[model samples]
Target: MRLLVTGGSGYLGAAILKRAPATCELAATYLAHSIAQGNAAAFRVDVRDADAVNHLFDEFRPAVVMHAAAQMTGDQMLAVNGDGSRNIARAATRVGARLIHLSSDVIFDGEHAPYDESAPPNPISPYGESKARAERVVLDELPRAVIVRTSLIYGFDPLDPRTRQTLNGEMPRLFTDEYRCPIFVDDLADALLELAQHEFVGVLNLAGAQRLSRYEFGIKMANAFHAAPRFTGALSASYPGRRPRDCTLDISLAQKTLRTRLRGVDEVLQDLPGF
Candidate 1:
């Protein structure tokens, strides 16, 4: 398969590159930091620029496109996540490539618990709104595209951002009420690869089997890291802006469909030595 992965420098993108099949012709795009994983060719292209995206798509002409490039926050969120997604979708459509766009659980308002594939997006925050918009544009451009909505992607190989922040004492308080199904990065990568070959389209919730609060996830990470967990628990209300309280996903469809086992955070943590 000729595969193209955007945001190759990001955590999940890097993991995918590392685990992708050797038989596949791999190509990845990054805005700044370039990657050198195996034989995967890295291209520096800004997804925000439609011309650049189209040019890369024309050159690579991938059989499958994993659109992982996104801006989670700040002023460029909408432009990067929403408009960038539209550009990728249109480019992939032109090339007749199977598009598997990564989405987030934050799209829901959190008033709804254990969201399934059919759950309509009711974003509460800017990040969520941007992702929801990304989903809409991607679907509009490529109706057959697989919109994979996932949760907190964590891995120990090169500690994920959230866990690293907590370990470095950058996070003062972890939310006790905010619930999510944090998937192991490896599991998510494997699942995405499996999805690439399949004909499955539309929204698919691919998250961890277990759901837990952010505080619980942090404590587990600290314990697994063999560091003293120091962060205090705080309710979502204490958070400055509106935060999703229960963005937990229902991965029953994914569980039933794919052979890839989506392990939970607890199971993943236990895989560590002396855990």
Candidate 2:
């Protein structure tokens, strides 16, 4: 099977490239950083540029296209999150290729405990609004397209110092009142590939099984990595914008349909080899 992955250098995309079957013909595109190791060919293209995206699509003619590229920001989530995704969706539709678009749990207002694919999006943040809009474009353009909504992705990155620091220090400290279901990037990559093989369509929540506060997750990370635990309480109100109290998702659909099982914190930690 030939597959094209956008955002090939990203955390999830890179992991997917690494885990994909050796027989699969892989082609990837990136805007900023390029992944050096993969069986697939890599191209530098901006997803927002329809012409550029189309050019690559025509050249690759992939059986499956994983649209993982998007613009994101910690301070401003809407501008890149919502608008940028729409552009990618448009290009994916134009190519008549099966698309698996990555989405986020932020689409929900965080009122409910565990949301399903049927849950109506009631986004409270600009970032959420962007993903909601992106979903609409994909469904409208291609009903067969899959929208995977995941949350709190955690993994170690040798090249990304920020990710390392966040996992080792800042992330644990932020976790007091904040709660989320964190999925490991490796597990998520496997799931995405499995999802690509299925005929599943529409929004599917891909997340870990357990609901943990930032503090609890930090403790788990520390234990897994043999690092000292660091946590400090912070009120949700202290943040600049409104956020859902608990945005964890229920991944029963993915677990039942896909080969990769969505694991909880304990399960994931147990699987983690000593490093």
Candidate 3:
């Protein structure tokens, strides 16, 4: 399979590149950060530019496109995350490539926990709103696209941003009430590739099997990094703006469908060689 992975240098994409099957021919695209793909070729393509994306499609002619490039926060959220997604979807359709877009659980408000694919999107944060728009854009452009809604991704090797932040003692207080199903990067990567080779489309929740609060997730990180639990104090998120409380996903469909198992934080942490 000729495949293209956007955001090649990013956390999740890097993991995918590392774990992708040997049978598949992979090319990864990056914006800024330089990636060292052992076998896969690395290309520079900005998803925000429609012409650039089209050029990439013409050049690479990828059979499967993993739309993982995203603008996580700030004012550029709509432009890079929303419009950028539209560009990718259109380009992917032009090339007749199966698009697998990565989406977040924050699309739904925390009032509802264990969200299924049928849940309506009611995003509170700017990032979440942008992702919700991205999803719509992808589906509208490519009806056969697979939208994988996942949660906080962690890798025990201290590469993932969230894992790095916690291990380095960057977070002052971890929210005790905020709940999410944190999946290991490797597990998520494997599941994504398995989904890519299939004809399955529409939204699918691909997250960790176990759901826990942000505080508990930090405790797992602490266990892996050998950090003090006291460093990650319990602090309920409080703000004037609406904050998602429990963006936990229901991965029952993925569990029943895919052969690749989505392992939880606890299981992953216990198996971490560095821990």
Candidate 4:
């Protein structure tokens, strides 16, 4: 199988590329940073640029296009998340390639517990709004598209500064009340690849099994890595933008359908080498 991954240089995208099966041919686009050296072919294409997206699709002619690239930040989330997604969906549709759009749990306000695919979107932040919009566009344009909504992704990546800080004890503080289902990047990538082969369409919540506050996740990380660091808990209301208190997802559908199982925090932590 030939696959095209956008944001090939990003934390999650790069992880996906690294974990993908060797039997599958991979091509990807990098923005802001140069592509990492690997067996996969990397191209410099901006998802925001329709022409560039089309050119890459035409050149690669991938059977599956994983749209993992987005303008992902609290500041520029709207422009990059919403508009950039629209361009990618359109280009993918034109190329006759199946799309697997990565979305976020932020799309739903954290008021409800164990959100499912049918839960109505109640985005409280610009980032959430953009992802929600992207979901709509991709599904509307291509009914066969897979929309995987994940949360608080964490994994090892030497190039990622956030991971570096956590490992170095520079920034170990986490929000106590900001609960989310954090998925391991490798597991998510495996699930996405499996989803790409299935007939399932529409939105699917692909997150960890456990609902954990940021503080708890930090503790688990520290314990797993044998790098215990001080953690700080804060209320979500104290933050600038509006945020949901708890937005854990129910991955029952994913568990029933996909080959890979959604792991809990304990499972993830135990998998750590030194834990």
Candidate 5:
């Protein structure tokens, strides 16, 4: 199997590359970061450029395209996350490659609890809106696309960007009201790779087993890193503008569908290696 992973240098993408199947031919894409660790060949790609995406597809002829690249904020969110996804979806359809697009729980309004695959997207933030648009575009362009809607990704060892910042006191304030099913980066990567080899299509909630607030997650990180000074007792309301609350995903379908065990935060962090 030939697999191409976009955002290969990203936290989740890098994790996926590390645990990817050896039998499969692997390739990775990056925008700003370097492909330092993986055996996969590196390709600099801007998913917004249809021609660039199509050219990569033609050259690589990837059997599976894992579209993990996306802008976090600003107008780039619309250009890269929204439209870039469409470009990738179109290119994947043209090349007959199975597309697996990464999505987020923030696509839905926090008013709803434990959202399912069928729940309608009512995004509150610019980033969330972009993901919602991306999902629609991917599904429209490639009906067979697998859109994996996940929550906040966390891990130690090399450490995730957000987690590392929190450890260094960079992200001092974690909201108490913003709830999510924080999945281990490895678990999510495994689920994505497993889905890549399957015939499953459409939306699937791939997240951790337990639902908890960001504050709760932060506390766990603090305990793990022994960094209690960074903790600022804040709520979601303390932040400027809108923030999604209680966007925990209902993963019953995923639990029944996937072979990989989607371990919860407590389970994952308890046995964490190398502190």
Candidate 6:
């Protein structure tokens, strides 16, 4: 299999690249930083630039494309996450490649809990709106694409950004009411790779088994890291803007669909040396 991974240097993308099959030929694209770990041929191409994305796709001509590139914040969120996904979908279709697009649980408004694959998107935040728009554009471009909606991705190898922030006292407080099913990066990566080798199409809810509040998750991570000055708990309403209260994904379909076991944060954090 010839696989192309966008955002190859990112946390999730790099995990996928590192865990890909040995027989598979790999290529990756990045906007700024090049992939430092994977053995794939790297190309620096921003996904927002349709021509650049098309040229890279035409050259690589991958059998499968994992569109993980996205912008979470700033004025370029729509351009990078929404329109950029469109570019990837178009390029994948042109190359006759199967596209697996990474989506977020934030797409939902959070009024409902335990969302399934059939749930419709009603984004509440800018990031959620961008990801939701990305999903729509990707599906419009390639109807056969797999839209894998996931939750907060956490890991301990290099430590996730959220955990890092908590450990270093970067964040003043963690929301006690905001709940999410934080998936282990390895589990998610493995699941994505397994999906890549299959013909599955349409949306799938892939997330951790346990649903936890941000405060609960943060506390566990901080405990594992043996950090001092714990993060104070606060309600979502305490913050300035509108935030999703609960975006827990129902991964029953994924549980039955793939062999990869999606472990919860508690199970994953047990891997720490003295946790």
The number of the candidate with the highest lDDT is: 1
lDDT for each residue of candidate 5 in 86-203, tens digit (9 for 90 to 100): 9999999998999999999999889988799899999999999999999999999999999999999988757888888877888878888889999999999999999999878889
List the global CA lDDT of all models: 0.92, 0.78, 0.87, 0.81, 0.90, 0.91
Model 6: how far residue 15 lies from native, Å: 0.7
Candidate 2 per-residue C-alpha lDDT over 1-275 given as tens digits, one digit per residue, 9 for 90 to 100 = 78998889887788889889887899998877978665779999876666777788788888888888775556534544555556666666776778898988888898886788898889887678777887887787778788999987777654234336655565534636667898888789899998888888877889988888766776776667776655565667777889877887989988888889888878877876664
Best by TM-score: 1
Write the residue-wise lDDT of candidate 1 on 34-82 in tens digits.
7857568889998899999999999999999999989887999999999
Q: Candidate 4 — which pairs collide?
A: none
| lDDT value, residue 1 of candidate 5 | 88
**Poorly placed runs, candidate 5 (over 4 Å):** none
Candidate 6, lDDT over the whole model: 0.91
Per-residue lDDT over 40-133 for candidate 6, one digit per residue giving the tens place of the 0 to 100 score: 9999998999999999988999999999999888999999999999999999999899999999999999999879999889999999999999
TM-score of each: 0.98, 0.91, 0.96, 0.93, 0.97, 0.97
Model 3's alpha-carbon lDDT is: 0.87
Q: Give the least accurate 10-residue stretch of model 3, judged by summed lDDT.
A: 230-239
RMSD of 1: 1.0
**Residue pairs in collision within model 3:** none
Model 1: residues with Cα > 4 Å off, grouped in runs:
none
The candidate, 2 or 4, that scores higher on lDDT is 4
What's the lDDT for residue 93 in model 3? Answer: 91
Q: Which of candidates 1 and 3 is the stronger one according to lDDT? A: 1
Decide which is better by TM-score, 1 or 6: 1
lDDT of 3 by residue, 22-125 (tens): 99899989988988677678889888889998988898899999989998978988998899999999998998899999999999988978799999999988
Q: Write the per-residue lDDT of candidate 4 for residues 1-275, one digit (tens) a residue.
A: 88999988888778778878888899988978976739689998867777887888889888898988887576767666677777778878888888899998988888987799899989887778888888887777787788898988887654245545665767646678888998888788889888777888777889998889887887777666666665566676777778878898989988888889788878976776755
